[model samples]
Target chain A: MRIIRYSEAINEALHQLLASNKKVFLIGQGVTSPWYVGTTTVGLIDRFGPHRVFDTPVSENAVTGLGVGAALTGMRPIVVHPRMDFMYYAMDQIANQAANWHYMFGGQMSVPITIWGIINRGGEQGAQHSQALQAIFAHIPGLKVVMPSTPYDVKGLLVASVEDDNPVIFIDDRWLYNYEGDVPEELYSIKIGKGIVRRKGKDVTIVATSYMVYKAIEAGKDLEKEGVDVEIIDLRTVKPMDKQLLYNSVKKTKRLVIADASWKTCGIGAEISATIAESKLLTTLKAPIIRITLPDAPAPASSVLEQAYYPESKDIVLAVENLLKYSCDNNEKCDY
Target chain B: MYKKKSVNTDIPLKTLREMYLTMLRIRKFEETVASLILKKEIQTPCHLYIGQEAIATGVCTSLRKSDYVFSTHRSHGHYIAKGGDLKKLMAELYCRETGCSYGRGGSMHIADPDIGLPGSSAIVAGTIPLAVGVAYSFFLQKKDNVSVAFFGDGAVGEGVFYESLNLAALKKLPVLFVCENNLFSTHMPISACLANIDIKKTAETFCIPTARVDGNDVQSVYKTAKKMIENARKNKGPAFIECMTYRWYGHVGPNLDIDKGLRSKEELDYWMKRDPIKKLERQMIQQKILTIAKKKVIEEMIKKEIDEAIAFKNKSHSPEKIDIARSVFKEE
Candidate 1:
């Protein structure tokens, strides 16, 4: 395996797609600028020229719709939203047009477009810039949402999303960009709607998405010294969610804890909790399920409030401990 | 078997008659929809194309089947004028499985890619960039096809309209922006909405060539659209056409809403006197091209066609319960 950073892996995926396919092009507000998109599209224009790499105006709605139109006309377009918060302006094109085209057209047409939104949380970017809105796209039908934690998954998933025949929301977080992991040199595609076990254990199963998976792994390592064998599962793709993988993990461990970098209400964690409750997976639970997510409030600009507004690795560790205590409380068995 | 002639819009007598017949078809189709909605047969928000037939037919005549036209909610005129199937469009409004979108999208979201009518979005100014993107693809692929975006005067106030105009001009993509200036944005007059109602001037700021036409006069609109389309095909960038017309019915439903206090009977009557079909009819008859009896025959034929479409929609079955969640993506 070859070693690569999360940032370069995405660039490699785009490079391979653009080099191999003539119909594949990039469009967004800051695609070619490395500083804006963080080297994801560096030197792409020099190689493929302007026809393939488009640096558009500050019109988010029109730019997104333009990508939709291009996708409908037999071109694969990867649209970048540097800061995902601004993507709210293009919700009409994303939800109404890109997500509804195939369904509205009776399956006769497909919008082969990939919307790559970068999450820029922390650094006191305030409420407008530092927000993880993957849950919003995950809630919409006709959209496949993917969030990769490792370099291998990010590169493979980006290629898979670009090759997919429907609109895919590929969300990446800046916190994980410099993080390095083993990746293969050749191009490949990871299967969507699948999750993998990051660290296997017999006790509580920790399910996480995107950068939260890295947080879960860190929490799991710390908890292991105290005899807490936490199983960590990285949910590579969220929307057509890896339901079977989640079910298998929860059934095996008999306890579940979901950690996410999104808000509490109507977030990915809430959806997963609902899925378990709806599917009667609660019957197999030894204790009540725990979800570690940010409180339902706007992100504060102050550093202290920002820390409280966001969920971190320590929060995952606390949630796992709470689950263990709840299990003991239910049985009145032992002291921690 | 029935393909529109677009090589040269010198517009022969036969093609002119064809355009006239096409306009009459759109008029009869929307009128049938209105009647059905009144009778509770068609259960959807029906936007009638009673007075603005010339705008769609004239602009669409200059486009080939390979050319794309993205439309707005008031879109039956553009869709039918671009040769969208009458039966499929009717079934879509009827919410039948045989509809254009298989009962998924109703009247506002009718789409059929076979004739290059990719979609009609209900949101105003939503599909403008989509049209530009289609042109971008055509330009990149080096295809001699132009994409048309048919929006109303309301969409001119939308930011995407200006953005689309700028990008299409900057890239010199083959796009023709058609604005059906019906003078109202959902009951608000153009005077109330914008400081300057000369919409083409906004496009000219982007250095794209512009044209203002008498929408009721189909011949003038046809000539202007043909030249712009040809210019885009020759890689001369985009063009704008502000067709001065009026929607006879209210903004939402099928009624002359003069009592709403937004428009006056005088304003309505002044535009109604410039009725596009009658204007073309007068020209055709004066040139000894179409007789009164022939006009009656064409009207009867289009009425029969509408009746057949309604019958087909009636006979069509509804989607099953299991099919409700399908087509969220292309089959797997």
Candidate 2:
């Protein structure tokens, strides 16, 4: 195992995929430049000539369409968008063309393409740059949405995304890029549509994604000190979400809290909460399904206001502590 | 009798006849589709390629099975000319299970990967950059296959089209940009919409070899397409062909007057005189290349084929609701 930052892990995964597969190439604006916003594609152009690592003009719609076209014709194109907000410009290509091509063509064609973007509420970037739109993409049926938090998870999930035959939106939180974790030096890939239990416990199930996974882990550590055991499930892929795993966990723990960095309205947290409510686990709840999410307003430009806009470890811990207190006070053999 | 130009005598009479037949097939198919729309049998908005058959047939003639082709709203002709199965295409139009897109993609979105026709988009100027990307793939693989993009004069106004053309020319990739200049985009005429109506001149601005042809003349379209295609195959870079054609029907559906009238009766009549299928039939008869009896036999054969296609489409099932979640992400 080697310690590396989240961005370096993605870079290593890309390097391995490119070195192994001759058909794999990179495309997008600033992808070939060392000053890539995420710094995930640094030194890629030097290793693999300019042809393999192309820098497209700032035509998001056209470039994304080009990536789809290339992928259909048997090239694995990794398109990098600097920020997730700019993806709206190419939504037609992503949602209409890339996602629907396979099903629309009756499985006659497959787009082995990956669209990577730096997401989450970055400091002082204002409303445009600092927003997590994973739920919006998750609403689309044809796309696979992956948001990996740790360096290990990023490396493994990215390698799998590149090799997969579908169009994947691999989201990287800008704030999590510098966060370091132990990653395997050998090439490996994590299975798509599977959630991992970061910390296994028996009392409550805390579901989180992207940067919120780390916050959940931190919250779980605090809960452990008070003898309130927590099971943390990191949902790497949000679209083909590991529904079975979530259901099984909810059934076991009976209580649930979702820590999502995105807004509350129709977010992935809402979907998970709904899924739990629809499942047999609804009878097993000890308290109402709790969600620690960002405010429904646009991210503020001020650093202090932006901090309040995003959910943090303290927010997640407080929500969990409240649930634990309610369970203890009502002690009727806690159904949830 | 019109004299047949033998610019490339090496191209066999049989090859020319085949090109003519392909164009006729598209023309007849569109006519049948139009009648179906008029009778209310087909429900979707149909963009008839009645007058622009030669452009599709001509460019598709030069493409191999390995080559990729992208098309636009006026795409039935391109799809059929590029070897798409008539039965599947009919099924798609009928919104049946046997459709190329399994009834999910209607009139404007028929795609058959087996024949190298990926798909067509309803959005104007959408397929230009896609074709360029496909060509770029061929360049990367060091393959001789060229990608063909079929669009209308309206596409020139789109920024993506200009960006794609610039990139294709800069990369010197194997691409054939076929502009079927039908003089109008929907109700607006090219002259009214564009500053420069000359598509070939616009292509020349990017240093791409440009050719202008009478789109009604199938032979002229075929000859120019062959030259441009050969040039691309030799890695001589991209070439642009502008076929000055006209759409017989209105922009959408069979009704000619459903929308606002843009073309005069005199203009329509003058263009009808140069009908591509009728012109080819006349040439074949005058030259004794195809006897009247033989022409009847060919018509009967095509009619039978179309009838069988309609029957197959009628028998095909509609898509299941459970299939909605499938194929979004490719399973390994």
Candidate 3:
């Protein structure tokens, strides 16, 4: 294993794919410029040549559809949408064409296209640039939505997505880019619809995704010091969720708290909450589930307001503490 | 001004007959669809390719079976001309299990990647970028395959059209953008939509080579498409062809759309004078290469094919419920 930042891990994965496969190519607005896509696409053009690593114009919809077209014609294309929020411009291609092309053509064709969308949260980026629109993508039936938090999973999931025989939406949050983690030097893949337990305990279950996984881990540390053990499940893939892992974890700890970066209403948190509720765990619930998410509104631009807009470790801690407090109160009063 | 090519004496007679037969087949297939819809044999909304058959036939004839074509909602002509299975296309419109898309994509999303027609879409200006991508793939592979995007004049108003043109030119990819300028966008005429209606000018502004031809004249469309496609395969970059044409049927369904007061009968009659099939027949007769008996024989053969396709569609079954869950991904 090699220690690397999340961005470098992704860069290594792409570099490996380009070097190993002649059929693979990269297309995006600033694939050659590190300033736009950062170190993730650095030195790609220099290594693989121009025909493979192409820097394109600011035509998101067309570029995305171009990626789909290339993928359809026996090419593995990793098309980058530098900002996840702006990807809505290319939603028609992503949702309608890329997602539905295989199914629409009776499964005779497959789009081996990996659409990489980066989530830029905070930085005074305002409403347009800061959205984590994973829910919008997850809602689409034909799309496979994956959100990788760690440096290792970032490389693994991206490779898995590229190898998958369908159009996969690989979403990454930039807030997790600079963070360091131990990633493998050899090429490997983590399955698309799997999750892992970051820190396991029995007091309460904390299911978090994307960058929110880091915040939930921090919250788990705080609770650990407070004698309340918190279990953290880093949900790597949002769409084909690891339901069995989550259900079994929830079965062990009846109290649940979900942390997500998207809107509170109709978000992944709500989906998880609903999934747990519909399962056999509903009868064993000690208290109502809590969700730590952004307020249901556009992100404010002000630094202070932005602080309030995004949920942090304190918010996760508070949600978990509140759920524990309610359960503890019920146990103390013998209110079974 | 676009220079019109004269009837070159160099081309083979068999090729000319094949192109003529393709246009007639499109006409007959659409006519069969019209009667099927009228008789309630098929239920999905269909945008026919009656008068505009020449453009599709001409453009597709210029392409190799290895080349790709991404088409619009009015795609029956494109599907047939590009060598898509007539039986599968008819079954698709009928929403049967044996359909090309297995009833998932009614008339709009017909596709046959085996024959280089990857797919078509109902959304206006949808497949334009897909074509550019296909061309980009050829550029990456360093191959000679050309990709074509066929859309109506109304689709030119879409932002994607300009974006696709810009990218295709900037990259100098092997792509051909064919805008069938049928003079109308649903109910509104093109004049009402765009302040300046020079369709080729926008593409030319992007430094891409542009051509405007009489869409109803099969020879003119065929000549321009072949040249541009050849230029694209030689890595001369992308080219845009604007074909002046008309849709005989309404924007959708079996009836004529002119009764909605969007267009006058006089305009329709004027365009009908430039009928592509008649123009091809006149040329063939003038050259004394094809007699009326031969033309009738060709028409009869096409009718039999259309009749067999309709029968196949009628006999096929609807997909079972489990099939719906299957095609969502490859793993299924």
Candidate 4:
């Protein structure tokens, strides 16, 4: 195993996908430009040529529909929107066409398109450019949403999305691109709706999505030094969530803190919290669940406003400590 | 305006008869659909194809069975013309499990991929880009097949329509864009909707070959569509045909809209005089290729087919509640 950047892992997955299947082609705006989609699409045009690496015009709706159509015709196409916020232009094709085609037309056809969207935050980008819309896509029934935080998961998830016989929304965060992890050379696919236990503990359970997984781990380490045990779960797929994993973890810890990289109102955290509240594990909770997420407002342009806008590992740490404090106050068996 | 090229005497009488048969089939099918809707037997909101049969019949008659066709909301004619199974389409309108879409999609989303029609979208201009992508796949696979997208003037307002045209011409993909300019987007007239009335000129701006024809005349539509379809198959790039036609019913359902004051009866009568079926029926009669008695026999045969389709629908089962979530994704 070799340590590689998350972006490099994505590049390798594209290379393997193209080589393995002649029908697989990458189409989107600025696919040929290394700067446009970051290093993930580097040297793709040179290696695969312009045909397989189709750099399309700035037509989000049509390009996304083209991916759906190509998939219908038995070709695997990955349509990319460099910015996740701009996918709104293609919501008709994504939500109405690609997502509905399989179910609408019965099982007669399959639209195996991987709609890859990148989440860009910070850098003074205003509300329009900075967004994490995985929750909106996760709400759609026909689509499967995957957000991988680690380099290893990114490569495996991308491979799995391309190979799946359904539309998959692969949302990646640019903030986690520089993170390095050991990745295998051979191509592999991670299951779509499964989650991973990043770190094991006996205290509060922290359920995190995408880049928040890294933040959760950071919070876990800090909590450990402060004499509070913490368990972190990386929710790789947003939709079709690993509810069993979360339920089992919560059943043991009897306390929960959800950290998500989106708005507070009806976000991934809300969904996870509701799931735990509805299940039989609701009886095991010693304290009320806490959600660490961005405030119910748009991302600000100023660096100072952005700091308060985005919830970090410290927010997770605070939520966990508060939960433990409450649990200890209510239950005599609690040890902090 | 391109001169009406005489229907080549060389195109065999059998092919010409088949063209007439397709148009007749569509007209009869839609007439029955309207009656069914009035009787409340068919619940789907069907966009009738009574007055626009020529374009679909003409274009589809020239297409191979393997050539793909993407259609819009008003698409019963396109499906029938493309050799779609009548029973499945009827079942779809009836919302039965035996439907083309397995009772999931109603009249607006009819599809038969087995006959090269992957699907039809209710959204304006939604299927345009899909057709272009299908053509691109054919080009990439070195297949000689061509894809046709049948949409109304309403789709031109959508941004994706031009995007599809740009990509199709840029790649020299094998596709035909058939604009059935029926002069209305729902209730708004095209004259009021479009800034420039020349739809063909828009295609010409993309540097794709363009043609405008009398859509009511099946021969003109068939001839122009044949030339364009052949050019696409030869890999000469995409082509556009603007078929000036009209829908007899209001935007949807069986309403003529005359009593509703949406459109004038005089206007309806004017277009009715140019009825595609009667125009083709007269031409065949004058050419001595068909007789009045023979035409009656053809009508009888079509009526029997429609009856059989209805019988099939009657026997078909409605979707069960247990299978409600099935086919949401491809099952492994």
Alpha-carbon TM-score of each model against the true structure: 0.96, 0.93, 0.97, 0.97
The digit string of per-residue lDDT tens for model 3 on A206-294 reads 99998989999888888888998988999999989999999989999998999998998999999999999999899999898998888
Estimate the Cα RMSD of every predicted model relative to the unseen true structure. 2.8, 3.4, 3.0, 2.9
lDDT of each: 0.89, 0.85, 0.90, 0.92
User: Per-prediction TM-score, chain A only?
Assistant: 0.97, 0.95, 0.97, 0.97
Ranking by DockQ: 4, 1, 3, 2
Candidate 3 clashing pairs, residues 3+ apart or interchain:
B250-B257
Q: Compared with the true structure, what per-residue lDDT tens digits does model 1 show for residues B153-225?
A: 9998888888888888889999999999989999899989998888888778998899999988888899899
Check candidate 2 and list the clashing pairs. A142-B328, A254-A336, A284-A336, A285-A336, A286-A336
> Which is the leading candidate under lDDT?
4
Better of 1 and 2 by DockQ: 1
lDDT of 4 at A322: 80
Candidate 3 docking class: medium
Q: Which ten contiguous residues of candidate 2 chain B have the minimum total lDDT? A: B2-11
Tens-digit lDDT track for model 2 on B55-129? 888788878988999988888999999998999989999988789888878898889888999988888888787
lDDT of 2 by residue, A1-336 (tens): 879998899889888888999889888888877766567888888999877888877778878887888899889988888888889988878888788888776777888889987784656889998878899999997889999988998999888888889899999898898999899987899998999999998888999999999999988888788888999999998978999989878888888999888889999999999999988888888888889888899989999887788888888778877777677777454443
Chain B TM-score against the true chain B, candidate 1: 0.96
Q: Residue-wise lDDT of candidate 1 within A105-149, one digit each (tens)?
A: 788889999999999988788889988998999999999999999
Name model 4 segments beyond 4 Å from true: A330-336, B1-10
CA deviation > 4 Å runs, candidate 1: A330-336, B1-10
